[model samples]
Target: MIKILKYTEYLYLAVAIASIYKIITLWGVAQQETYIFIFFAVISIAMFLFRRNYRRKFEKRKQDNQN
Candidate 1:
């Protein structure tokens, strides 16, 4: 579980960083490409946040089970 969480965190960070890079290079591109980069960034951050919340819930459940 810990390994998976760590991997997810890295993946999300990578996607976000990539999107920012894309935006910085979007000078000669069309508007649609810019939108796509923004969308990817938003979704990646949302997934990261949601997974973090879920992990807290899972930890709570584990604690309850141990008790």
Candidate 2:
């Protein structure tokens, strides 16, 4: 479970980095590109939040099971 969480954290980090790169490179582009980058950034944030909640739930369940 911990291993799974660790991997998820890494994936979230990667998505964030990619979004940052996209925004940086597209900052000077047209509004359409800017909007697209923003969309990707939002999705990245949502993914991270979901992963965090999922890990927390998994940990709680594991503890409950052990008890």
lDDT of 1: 0.83
Question: What's the true lDDT of residue 42 in model 2?
Answer: 81
Question: Which structure among the candidates has the greatest TM-score?
Answer: 1
Estimate, for each residue in 2-64, the C-alpha lDDT of model 1 and write its tens digit: 669867867997898899789778946767898899889988888888877887788889899
lDDT per model vs. reference: 0.83, 0.81
Q: Which residue pairs in candidate 2 have backbone atoms (N, alpha carbon, C) closer than 3 angstroms, thus clashing?
A: none
For model 2, how many clashes? 0
Query: 7-63 in candidate 2: lDDT tens per residue?
Result: 887687687778778888888876688788778778877888888888889899999
lDDT score of residue 45 within candidate 1:
86
Best by lDDT: 1
Q: Clashes in each model (backbone N, CA, C under 3 Å)?
A: 0, 0
